[model samples]
Target chain A: MSLHKKILIVILVASAGAFLWMEQQQNNFTSGTDGQSASLPHPGHSAPDFTLEQLSGEGLVQLSEAAGNANGAVVYFWTSWCPFCSASMEAVENAHRVHGETIHLIGVNVTSQDSKQAAENFLKKHSITFPNVMDQDGAVADMYYVPPVPAVFFVDSGGTITSRKTGAVTTGELEQEISRLKEAD
Target chain B: MTEPFITWSVGPFTISAQMLFIFIAAAAGYGVMSLYLKKLHVENRGEILGTFLTSLIICAVIYKLWPFILDPQLLISPGNLLYFAGGPYAVYVSAGVAVIYFFLQSIRKKWSHHSLDSFMAAITTALIVFSLGVKNYGLPSPFSFGYMYEGVMYHAVNFYYSWLFLLVLLAALILVPSSKKYARSITMLTGLVIAYGLAAPFQV
Candidate 1:
């Protein structure tokens, strides 16, 4: 047989084997159900209301009040220890600076697993000027069903959640969400 | 402290750190491969360019197709294919494609084993540069030299591998005698084996 013919046969057999192996792996994952919960507050639902003390200790900030006053509000749940949160804080701060007049940007510190002093240091190090409230006992995070740190929830003027994004948020992404909020108003 | 993810906004487009590093790695690999081949007095340098381009195309197709094959449900849309397809498996597939292409070229062109040595050196240089940008820190260690990933410190395994591969490339270049028969093949095989062996303990 020609060398090209042999190579073709080998390629075909190898591809077939890889396909079968991947299919089997997919089946196993699907059968195991993966343990992911479906309890997250989906978009278009009313955002759960909560009032938490500001990090600066000036006063308490209510989510419903902030959303009602502005075009919309961005409730960002974050922790000082999460590496992604630290990386994403700059983008969130930028978004606030650009759209703070029209949109209320509220950063909620998840203090259950992180120290309050560390969170204050994180804000100071980043030069974040927006209002940040401390979720001291993590009851607010549980109310929102936040799965991870650096989660951003966009809530409209009607207190309805427009969207929920988990993980790090880029400047462009935060801007896009702000634009969407403005358009909804 | 190293940032977990880096990105730059260019007008409407955003370029991630990973994409920038991959581009730099590819360019450096091609340039190094061309220089090494020229040093060995290989006249047909265009073959190296052709081989690299062909391997890239084949790797991309394999990367996109593998996920769809795994779960036909992922074939719902083009966006889904892009989102779900490529990962570590694509690197393995690309390496396999490059090897097969090189083997075929060796047979067809009657190329010397020294050409294979140059190719291996090119791969090592690319991987060394890639390791600098990739986030592959291994298990947590008590050592202070490690990097902090998410509050906890982990061994900078990728950094260690990068230095090891660089040493292998340098040894292949200096220690192997160009005039000796099968010297290039021996150096290439030995460098690869040693590098892989060193990397085995760090693999997650």
Candidate 2:
């Protein structure tokens, strides 16, 4: 065989080997034998737990504590200034009103970027009724490594982050993600 | 590794490793295509580059407008077109449109199979870099290459893909002589398809 043919064979063999290995791993995850996530906040991993004061009110809210909801939780990180965040806030609020009974929507205001007063005004202006938390020091934001405002994370009842979006999400998209979370439940 | 995503904040906005890598991949693909054309001494270089640019612009436009199409209410925030692009479905749609555009352009240009193969090589380069940026790892594993997330070690499937695509790119550049025609490109695509099929099971 020519060098070209030889190279092709190598690529084929490697891909086949990877595919077989993947099949085994799938079996492992399905059997609950080896599917545990690290401390990082990516999908398929357990969402790092954190506690913060509610944005508009008193008392603190913890992430793992909110995992008791039937469909799980939606963790939203935002600042008052981001236009994308402002636009998506309506969708988040609507989701909360419709599915508030089944899912926990925890909004985190990156207060380090915005003043407490500004954050409160933005929430009030939008008529957001969900539980909004203040990441006063930005510690929780650091824990999740949020990329820009309007970032959203969906955590399953088991605490694993099912999906995450980095930009503004539509109401339909939120509903779709919520439906997937429900299906997972 | 401990941190899977590398992120940096610019003002109030943060950019992640994945986004940075996507830009890098697009540049690499374009660069590779230019280099390959230069090596071949293709006469219609400007036309070929223009065709590629058209496809890229088309993909970007579709991706940006996809959200509005999905939910016209998003138009309420006209500024949203600046930040939010459509989701995975948008990516699929954009890519499909680009591929179809490429086919039509190829027909119009009457480009040879060898030229198309070279184009595939450029795409392979982009895919290699993209796999690296996305950290598309798979299920728990015992291998040393596995990244420790939380506590379990998962397969670095993206790296696996990158390695495979790198080989394909190298083969496209170095192994396939002009006489070999379409052999390397076909093999490289087939291998990637098979690899993607197999490794998808391991992805999180």
Candidate 3:
């Protein structure tokens, strides 16, 4: 056989091998529980602490301090560009109105993709009352292993994560998660 | 640290590590191609440089404009045009344009076979480096070699591709006869097909 023909055959074999491997990997990805929440930190792990500047011109809000004081702290990672965050902010705002005293509701605005001005405007338009911190460098979001916007992590008073929710959450879900965090001791 | 991607803040600008690596790889590839052309006794280095620059500009233009062409509504806003347009398809379009340009150049200028070989070698080298820096994680595996990204384990597809492309580079260097016509085209086609097949499952 010619050298080019032999090379062509080898190429075909290699291509087939790659195709089969990819297919097997795809099956594994689908069959496993590595779904949307795979990128987030798990419950029982200590929450990653961060001190970010509050958007309201208030002093820095540290995660460890907030979690230690309130019944539990709800750390929300969001961005102004995400459409889901707008609706979720309303639910969070309502939850904050009723459970403001018991829980520390802190929003960490991922400013890597969105401007601080845009985030501030979004908060104002939504009438969100909870203190929101500006994660200018996205270090906080990176620490929490946040994948997408509208992610919430519920940490107990001891700073151990109790639960995490990816994407938007309703008022009931938010309340239930907070209650769970409070009962986690 | 475990994630495949990295973002670095330089003063006021945040830059992607992948983009930086790709830029370095392209420059290195051009240098290697220039050296290879010299070794092959192919003169007219300026022509090679011109072709490279033209192809690069054409690729960038097509990459940015192809999206707007497909979706006219995206043209309404500059932000929308930039955000919504051009992804994996842009790479395909760029490669197609480069290949057509090379073929036309070869016909018009009567370029030597060695020049084409050098071009292929340059691409393979750059791709090998590019794969290492880019996120090409495979599915989860129980083996020791698997990479843990975020919270999930993956097969380290980028590492696999880097080694695979290296082998392809070796084959092009040693196995293919230097005098062979269309050797680069054959090697490139084979490499591209294998790469596409390997990368298919990971596409989102």
Candidate 4:
């Protein structure tokens, strides 16, 4: 190839290399796992069921318990370490206060937390009425296809996933989610 | 490696070796692009990259030293070097310096065709270098996602933004003479940098 052609070739190869590297990095950096997140069932797919130790320290709150309520349940995934996750709990509590009894709001707590008591205490202090289930291994989080959280998932009475949000959501937003689920119901 | 280096704050962020590589790659883009300009025998290469690097350093100093930059008696109480990361004016300053750099490039080039690939490569390198800064190595802010699509979109944004920011710089550079090879090269890079910057943002 001529010198000019050589330069052209170099640029094309270099750009292609950069582009490919970028593509690969994007895939890796974004927490992508082939079928890991893809396993996230679309709406209408069966929402996985789980048994979580409730905050009451009494019995486990099974997904089966809320199987057929007129209003579906909202499951929020959070980590004690994340400020955004904590902020999201405040929002969850707020939603509980507004739509008490009508809608079920459950928190799926990740047990990998350094201070489980601190997290629980935060929820208790906030006066959150919803039942919180502990996920020690983060299995439930994977089931929901949750990305680095503060996330929320809405499930219909039939235990099918309806809608979900991944970041900070307000009580009003949760209320909107409830209404949307109710409408779908 | 990523977990301890990473923490959640007011924003979603990343701090791992992989994230480190992205920034390295971006700097490489800067170096490599300069080589190409050299082959094209574009004059004033040092003036371009040197000014660009100097401005970048200034931005970092301002970002980190924001607290000191602020009046001590004032309630704002500015006092650190990492302040630039959180500085409200950081982006504007970086973009502004890039504009000036483009103008410098403009004095040498002819018709600027600044393509997206060229712009993207240079910026990716620049951000990679910024990420390597010792003081404020964590994600500038907290991570968030309201929409399902955002989860996926977030990954692709860094790729797009680096190029876009450079495109903006390139746009500023391309507005000069058209007859000179130096001017032409400068024009192309200017267009690339400016266009890319204009197109990429929310990714950050």
Candidate 2 lDDT over A1-185, as tens digits, reads: 67767866687577667668757756865686544556557788678888889976768888888866467899999999888898789889999999988889999999988999999899889999999999988888888876467789999888888888888878877898888888888
Clashes of 3: 0
lDDT of model 4 at residue A73?
83
Order by DockQ, highest first = 2, 3, 4, 1
Among all windows of ten consecutive residues in candidate 2 chain B, which has the lowest summed lDDT?
Answer: B1-10
In model 3, where do residues sit more than 4 Å from their true spots? A1-37, A40-108, A111-140, A143-185, B1-4, B67-88, B150-152, B195-204
lDDT per residue, candidate 3, A151-184, as tens digits? Answer: 7888889777777665555565677788787777
lDDT of 1 at B41: 80
Model 4 reproduces what portion of true contacts?
0.00
Compared with the true structure, what per-residue lDDT tens digits does model 2 show for residues B69-169? 88777677567778678774888999889878977898788876655765687789889878877776466765555676656677787887787677666
Per-prediction interface RMSD?
17.4, 3.7, 11.0, 13.7
- Please provide TM-scores, in order, for all candidate models, with all chains considered together: 0.49, 0.87, 0.56, 0.41
lDDT of 4 by residue, A1-185 (tens): 34754654465456546555654554465444432231223444456788888656867877746646647788888767766666556667877777657678888777755357877787766677777878877777766655456667788877767765555554545666788777876
Best by lDDT: 2
Model 3, span B1-204: residue lDDT tens = 123335566784544555677676687778878887777677876697678757667766786676566555545655544333243255688778986886688668888776667778778888888877775555455445656655666666666677667667766666777778868658765976676556556432
Cα lDDT over the full model 3: 0.71
Candidate 1: list runs displaced more than 4 Å.
A1-185, B1-5, B69-84, B148-153, B199-204
Residues B1-204, model 1: lDDT tens digits: 122234566774555455677777777877788888788787667776577667656766776566566456545544454334343244587668767887688668877765676677777888788777765545444446666644545556677667666666665666566767567657766766766565544333
Q: What C-alpha lDDT, on a 0 to 100 scale, does residue B68 get in candidate 1?
A: 61
Docking class of 2: acceptable
